[model samples]
Target: MSLLDFDADQLAAFAAEVRQDYDVLKDKDLKLDLTRGKPAAEQLDLADALLELPGKGNHHAADGTDVRNYGNLAGLADVRGIWAELLGVELEQIYAGDSSSLNIMFDLVSWAYAFGTNDSERPWKDEETVKWICPVPGYDRHFTITEKFGFEMISVPMLEDGPDLNAIQELVKDPQVKGMWVVPVFSNPTGVTTSEEIARGLAEMETAAPDFRIVWDNAYAVHTLTDEFPPVHDVLGFAEAAGNPNRFWYLTSTSKITHAGAGVSFFASSVDNLDWYKSVASVRGIGPNKVNQLAHARYFGDADGVREVMRKHADILAPKFTKVLEILEERLGQYEVARWTEPKGGYFISLDVIDGTASRVVELAKEAGIALTGAGSSFPLKQDPNNRNIRLAPSLPPVAEVTAAMDGVATCVLLAAVEKLGA
Candidate 1:
């Protein structure tokens, strides 16, 4: 019977039983983590060949620019061409940067703050109150970046397909709202992909800020857990058609596609946006690691090579994600105390415990020696109004460890719900 179906005395009895199980779990002293979605060691090993690449005395780029020395501020034309194909853009529009895509993103936004984009009349900092719209249950780091820059963060609901467009259309009325953050495909936690309608709507929507931008973070463009290769909507193309050619700043990385730490990051925009980005980038540093960029070029000869690499990652990751789903269903399916996303691709499973019990569930799991992402981490400022969301990352650990941690997690969920009902 359901906990809600029980009378006061019965609820009390169930709570006592759950408490006993909790005590037993505590005695076991288990230690496991399901925090961030870090690529597993096996996934990183796929790009190990890049280490010995660009063989000695062969540092000449396809354009004849020696990568060992500094120059090509926009990156080697050959590497840019490879990245342009991956990003679905013209070669001149994309700029390959250092290992971290987040670094490139940070620099872009920082430049917007300091100097603004081509569309803006003045720097973003000139505004009395700059803000950004963020889809909730998003990547926490995105919110942190905007928040750190003193941009007021506004949360918009994330729906089955993507963000609620109605909310975004309304939020952009404020000229102070400079832009929004989007994961585009295989989004973090929920794994929500921007549909054609949603993508088109976002690109064409009118905004008060002429400089309003779409931080199009296509972090998982090619990451598919299933066999189907979903097509990416050409946001840049759509925006250009909408007469908003300079409205988007596209970003991507080889972080998950190749080596996590050593991967090259990329950004693509319009001709004007290109001038803005490269101009700012030139002042910040000389150039990205063209040597590593060259190594990546050789490793992934073309877009097809990237697809093959992701296939290998899916082969290693799909089973672990499946195992997590299986454990969640077996242990908690009957109770209905919790529900979780069965993501098709991307790095995490977004789980929602009974309202008011999420934080307690994580607390109980911690005492049992399992560390889950803090409850509400999926929301902006790490605040979930109902305290119901928890993100589970199965990629970092082996399948067996994922199983063990999830089992304990389910137990904690049930116990927390029962205790709450009894109280």
Candidate 2:
């Protein structure tokens, strides 16, 4: 039963009880953090062998290219082949880069702003207005990138399958809407994988902008909580079949698979798009870190090697995620004042509190020394219209810490809801 269904006196009594719990939480002096979806220490340990990988004086790739020297702007074939198999792209379509896929994403947008895309009639910087479609409760860093470039961000709700395609289809009718960002599989916070129907819609949809692009950031492509890996859609191929070969910019990284800071990044796209990217990228630098690519290539001898590593990551992470979800249900299930995702994969659980109490809940949690991702963090511009959503990250903390943090968080949510109800 919902706390809303309780009588005035019942509500008041519940409020008092929750207040007591909150006070006790504060008194416990807990210093727990549930902020970022970073891999835990244990998860990192699984890839420790990479620290001494490719051994000393072993500097050649399978093709006998000297990895010690620069100029494989495309990266090692073995490395690209491994990721190509994993990401469902052809070997020729993928470009393995340095550690950060975010860097590659930023460069794509920046390059478009400066030089336009392969299909662009003019540079985005020269446009009268550059608008972007951002799925709400989406990735903050993605929004930050567009925000920095001064693109007008249009928000659309994220559905169980993916971003609201109806809304997106309408938004793209204007030529100013240059692009959109999508995580595709096990999206951030919500863990809503884009179904094939939605993926096809995104691929087949018509847009007024000749250079409209989709930055498909598959950051968690292989980060599954289950034994089975999620399907990797052939989005680039979908676009090609839809006669929009240049519509998608596919990206993925081994950041979570290996070392977050030192893993390899990948970019795959149409031949024209790749040509366009290389034209400018070559001017910027001689090549990516081929030696590090060699290390990662040597570390994961094949695609299955990457999957085995992820399975180990799953073993470490699944328990922490389970604990958080269980605690959320045990503590807040009866009240019906909140809802959260039970993600099978990905690093976050999207929690929606009472219509306007999310900020209050976060504040109460902070006062009790439990740090959470800020309120409305999952939305564009850090603004959730209802002030209701919170992203809970359980991947970084240990299971016990996740339990404590989530329990404390539940108390905060109850307290905030009761106070908002005038109890």
Candidate 3:
């Protein structure tokens, strides 16, 4: 039965029982973390062959450019082409860079702030106030970037299909709303894939800001948990068809695919947008890390190679996800105090606890030596209006650890919910 069905005495009894369970959890002196979605050591080991890749004299790219020396700002065609095919964009439309798609995103925002985008009448810094649309229970890092730049982040509810289009369309009517962030496929935490209908709506929406760019961060486009991978949507094409050819800025990286800190990043958009970015990028540095890009190229010979490696990752990851879901269901099912997304892809599972108890749940978990992503982290400025929503990252921990951590977490959830009820 739902916890709501419990009377005061019954709820207090249950709370006492849950507190005993929590005491036992703390007694175990366990130190388990579910903070960030880092690849497990075993998952990293799958790409160990990359260490000796592009060995010695194999320094030249297929285009006859020496990767050892500087200046292929566009990166190696072999690697670029591989991602191009995988991302469903043309090779020339995409450019590869050293790891960290976040860095590329930062530069784009920074550059726009300093020099303005191709369509910007003036640099963003000149604006009276720059606002950004953020999908709630979205990626924290994405919000961090805009927050750091002092942009007023407006939160929109993330529906099952995607970010609320009706809300976004209304928000963008303001000229100061410069851009928005989107993890198009298997979005962080929520795992809500942007339906093609939503994708087209975003691309075609009439934003007052002529240069209203959408940061299409497809971080988990290929990181599937099932046998079937989600399709890479033609977002740029959607923009082009809508007469806004440069409406979206596409980005992806092999950080999770290969070595997290030593993989290649990619950017794709209109030819004009690509050239404009390079114009700014050219002044910043000589080129990207071609040697490392070539090494990645050698590691994943082509697009299929990436899929094969991801499959190996799925093999290791699927069970951990299943375990987490099983624990959440088994422990919290009867009470109905919580509900979590059973994601098909992506690195996180979003959990919604009883309103006003998420922070308490996280606190209880921490006191019991379990680390979870901070409560309200999925919202703008670290504020969840309802004080619910927790992002659970199961990718970093082993299956056994995931089980223990989740069980302990469930106890905290129940305890917090009961405490909120009885108080």
Candidate 4:
């Protein structure tokens, strides 16, 4: 029955029962975390070969450049080629760096503020009011980078097709709205890939700022958990066709694919944007970690090898995600007190509970020794206006632990609902 069907006395009795159940949970001393999309140990084990990789005497890059030496700032040529086949970009458009693409993102925004991008009339910091669009229930880290730059963040709804492009187009009509952060494929915390239609629209849309950019973080491009994974299509072609070749700068990494801190990062863009980025990046160093990139190229061999490893990851992750979903359904389905996204390919399942109860649910989970992503993390500045959305990261824990964590979480959801309804 729906939670609304219960009368005051029933709710009170049910709430009391839930309280007792929670007390039992607290005493159990469980220490489980469902807080981040970190890979499990065994998952990390899949890339163990990278440790001794390029093995002895295989230190030369594909083009015969000594990878151990400085220079080749664009990174190993073959490494870029591997990602080129996957991202559908020409190799010249791609630049590989060290492990964290998040670093690349921060650098881009930071440099753009000081030196400005190719089309900018002046540095972003010079603007009277710098603004950016953030898709709600989106990646918190993405929001943090832009927010740290002091940009006025405008939150728009992130639908299954992607961020509300209509809202984004309208927002960019203001010259101060300098850019947007996007995860075009298998977006963070939602797993919804932006449709080709949306991608095309973004490429063609009019903006008041000539330097407006789309910082596309396709982090989950190969992190598919199922077969329905959609490739992010021809964004560059569409942008060029729309006469806005400078509109998007794409960032990606193999952090989740291989060792989290040891994989290579990539940034792809138009020639002009890339040239500008290189000019600003030249002072940082002569090159990135080519040793890591060389290790990756030797490990994967090609695009096909990358996909094979991802399939192994799916074998490990698919079950944990399934267990979490099964528990959520079995516990909360009958009550109709919640709804959630069953993602085909990303690291998270976005859950929504009855209004005003999300923070209470998270608090209850914590008291029972289970940790979850904070309730409002999906929104810009961690504020969920409706207090409903919850991002469940089922990727880190083992399958059995995921089952336990979700059970605790479901109970907390019920307890919070009962308290709020007062029956």
TM-score of each: 0.97, 0.99, 0.99, 0.98
List clashing residue pairs in candidate 1.
none
In terms of lDDT, which candidate is stronger, 3 or 4? Answer: 3
By summed lDDT, which 10 consecutive residues of candidate 2 come out lowest? Answer: 46-55
How high a TM-score does candidate 3 get?
0.99
lDDT for position 24 in model 3:
98
Over 28-102, each residue of candidate 3 has an lDDT whose tens digit, in order, gives 999999999999999999989889988988988888988889798888898999999999998889999989999
Instruction: Name model 2 segments beyond 4 Å from true.
Output: none
Which portions of model 3 show Cα errors greater than 4 Å? none
Candidate 4 lDDT by residue in tens digits, 1-423? 888898778777888988898888889899999989899998999999999988788889868988888998889888999998899999988999999999999999999999888899998888898999998789999999887988899999999899999999899889899999889888888888899999999999999999999998999998888754567687988999999999998999999999998899999999899899899899987889888899999899999899999999999999988898899899999999999888888799999999998998999899899998999998888899999988999888888889889999998999888888875
As a whole number from 0 to 100, the lDDT of residue 141 in candidate 3 is 97
TM for candidate 4 is 0.98
What's the count of clashing pairs in each model shown?
0, 0, 0, 1
Flag regions of model 4 displaced more than 4 Å. Answer: none
Q: Measure candidate 1: CA RMSD.
A: 1.5
Model 2 over residues 229-333: C-alpha lDDT tens digits? 999999999999999999999999999888898989999999889999999999999998888898898888999998988888999999998998888888889
lDDT of each: 0.87, 0.92, 0.93, 0.90
CA RMSD of all predictions: 1.5, 0.7, 0.8, 1.0
lDDT string for model 1 (1-423, tens) is 655777888877777877787788788788899998899999999999988998898798897888999877778776788878777789988888878878877877888998988888999989898989999889898888897898898999888888889999999998999999998888888988889999999999999999999899989888889876667888889999999999988988889877887888888888889898878778878888899889999888888888888899999999999998998888788777888888789898889888998999999999899999998887778899999998999999998888888888888998989877764
